[model samples]
Target: MCRWLAYMGEPLRASTIVLDAKHSIVAQSLDSPLGAETVNGDGFGFGWYPSDATPTTEPAVFHSIEPAWNNQNLREITRAVESPLFFTHVRAASGPPIQQTNCHPFRYENWMFMHNGAIASWPELRRDLTVAIDPSLYPQVLGTTDSEVLFHLALTLGLRDDPIKAIGQAIRTVETVGHAHNVQFPWQGTVAVSDGATMWAFRYSTSGRTRSLFHSTDVPTLREMYPTVERLATFSDNAKVVVSEPLNDLPGVFVEVPESTAVTLDGDGYRHQPFLAA
Candidate 1:
């Protein structure tokens, strides 16, 4: 229902991905060709590790009820700040109240999570899903959106220790609850999560048709392919981006994540694994 992008690799200004690209995240906020909603203007949020010295382990978050395209603060911060990992999301509220808290890229400690999907029949499934969350995490459920609930559900299932399995279990729970309520096609869209270092992205749905997800190919290869494109030099070899859609139309620049798969991107590169009900 929305559009989002996650970056992991060498530290670079957030604008490089969020605002500077040919089809940047800011641009997508107004014109998302891949999202279920064409214009994701409900609100926007960003979460990133601070570059300055600090003892804090939590990532900094900025959320606003204003449309991202019109937010001058976002433009200023994106150009000034840099991070090894960051998440930017433009919201298209499915049914949640439009508030800063409802904006995405939700955080817990060093972890940042965002989703571009919805839980079908959410009103009917909300009570069951909330009850399913571990009581320890129940208090952290500050928002009413199914997306935020799903995040806490993943945490309840042990996202901090094993993100892959945690997310798998969370989805399985959603499917179970949806089935019990007779809600067909209970899941949709791509999700991205990060712990300020490693990133995990998933593309899956109950009906087998998930939303768009793409990852950039190696920067070095892209440079060789388009030698005259000087912007490629701005990124380090380790740089990688997982986005709802390609930021640019560069051929071979983005590879679509297959349906029912989890993609892990780290310093070693990207790896894909099967994602099924667990």
Candidate 2:
């Protein structure tokens, strides 16, 4: 499994959350209490849309096979860049080998995606799923991991037009194919995605028991809840974050995303809906 986070709202240096938070993403790379694996040091990646980028502009990415905590380049770049929307991921390889291409937060055009779960018996289903991808989108499937394949599958299913439905359809296809192969509980994990503006997060699995995921309470609410916590002062009222784990110990600062749900974050704040429904 892996630990990842998505942020949207006021522009802030990526390191503010990836490196400087009390229990930042980089810290989770070495010690994650909620991730399936305690240490997600297999590799890491960062993707963000520059402050100047339009809603459809492509995001820039920085990926490395190095552990997030040990990568000076990540620190340097994160500290130097600021964005209103960005994704950071720390990988704990389930099966795929650690490499740049295999890292999470895979990109396509203006969208970026990352996952913290796996396809049960991926090797058995890869061919059937891969062959289903639209030929036009298949070329962008650069890595062998099920995560990347899932992204391309979503694209083939119309991610650009309707992200939430496309992702649900992608998962549905995976489960349908898995059932044919007699693999039960074929999907497990949380996923986060964005298209330079709005951000979406999903928590689901073939079984009801999915991975842990949470979204930050609105900044004003958090500030009132933790008035003395100086860090609360750094965020704006509209700021929202979705993470695989709570970044800090503040009791009400983070709200757990319900199982089998999708969360959308934008100027309208966070909205939740049932995901992968019939």
Which stretches of model 2 miss by more than 4 angstroms?
none
Model 2 Cα lDDT, one tens digit per residue, 93-154: 99989889999899999999999999999999999999999998898888889999999999
**How does residue 20 of candidate 2 score in lDDT?**
90
Provide the overall lDDT of each model, using Cα atoms, as 2-decimal numbers.
0.91, 0.91
Residue pair clashes in candidate 2: none
Clashes of each: 0, 0
Q: 232, model 1: CA deviation in Å?
A: 0.2
- State the lDDT of candidate 1 residue by residue for 1-278, as single tens digits: 99999988888999988998999999999999887988999999999987552434689999999999999999999999988888999999999899998999899877899999999999999999999889988888788899999999999999989999999889889999999999987887689998876799999999988889999999989988999998999999999999999999989999999999999998899999999833
Runs in model 1 lying further than 4 Å from the true structure: 52-56
Residue 257 of model 2 has an lDDT of 92
Per-candidate TM vs. native? Answer: 0.97, 0.98
